[model samples]
Target: MATLLHIDSSVFPGETSSSRSVTDAFRKAWGEQHPEGRVIYRDLAADPVPHITATAHLAGLAPASERTPEQSAALAARVELIEELEQADAVLIGAPMYNYSIPSTLKTWLDNVILAGRTSGETPSAQGTPVVVVASRGGSYAPGTPREGFEFVQNYLEAVLKGSLGLEPEFIVPELTMAPRVPAMSELVPLYHASRERAFVEAATKAKDLAERLAV
Candidate 1:
């Protein structure tokens, strides 16, 4: 059976979070396509992973037999996360922009999984795995937008997920998410709704497409 690794890093819960809502849509569509498929979910806000430490970092470079007791424990934690990625047929991430970047919890997860000569390097263990990223933001940061240069969530993920790990990444962005909440941006509420609707459609369509591809 197919397995999906879903990670949500939104601080908000349920439908209150735009990224979470969209990711939920994608997951629902995926479930419909593969009723028997397995899903491994991680809610970073509720249960965040430990940040990489000096011991953990160094342990990755050392042989298993040579690691100290402390290093062995730290490395074991990282290995668990890495093994999840390697075992997954696909990955889904809710990476809402926080201060023009991804959440610290998500970054911590990446740091743990990305080990040199293993999950990364010339032949990554999870290479070619398809990863769908739901990158919702409060404002517009697309090309030609005023704050385009300030966009770091997708850019950083692209570098780490695709460039380093060799994963196939496809993004579904829902921008201007703060339009309805922020008074000053009230005029853009319509645009925000449009973007959100498009994101939902894309999420469902992409989920089905991926399911079909995996089934084949």
Candidate 2:
């Protein structure tokens, strides 16, 4: 059976979070397609993984036989995360833009899983795995927009997930997510709704498409 590693980092819960909502739609579609598939879920906001520490960093670099007790303990957590990524057939991430970038919890998760010569480098263990990222944002950041250059969530993730980890990444972005809540951005509320609707459709379509590909 196929295994999907699904990670959500939004501070908000349920439909309150644009990223989570879109990811939830994709996951629902995926579950429908893969009734017997396995899903490994992680809610980073509720139980954040440990940030990389000196011992953890060094432990990853050092040979297992050379690691001290402290290093072993710290590295064990990282190894578990890496193993999950390596074993997964697909990956799904809810990466809401936080101050023009990804959440710290998501960054920490990346740090834990991206081990050189293992999950990363010239030949990564999980290389070519398809990853769908829901990169939702509070405001518009598409080309020609004022904040176009400020969009780091997708750009950074593209480099990290595809460039570093060698995963195949495709993004479904829901922009102007704060339009309904922010008084000044009320005019963009319609646009937000359209973007959100499009994202949901894309998520379901992509989920089914990926499931079909995986099954083949």
Best prediction by lDDT: 1
Residue pairs with backbone overlap in model 1: none
TM-score of each: 0.99, 0.99
* Candidate 2 accuracy as lDDT: 0.95
State each model's CA lDDT, in order.
0.97, 0.95
Superposed model 1: Cα runs more than 4 Å off = none
List of clashing residue pairs for candidate 2:
none
Q: Which 10 successive residues of model 2 have the least lDDT summed?
A: 113-122
The digit string of per-residue lDDT tens for model 2 on 10-42 reads 999998999999999999999999999999999
What's the TM for model 1?
0.99
Task: Find the 10 residues in a row with the least total lDDT in model 1.
Answer: 31-40
Q: How far is candidate 2 from the true structure (C-alpha RMSD, Å)?
A: 0.7
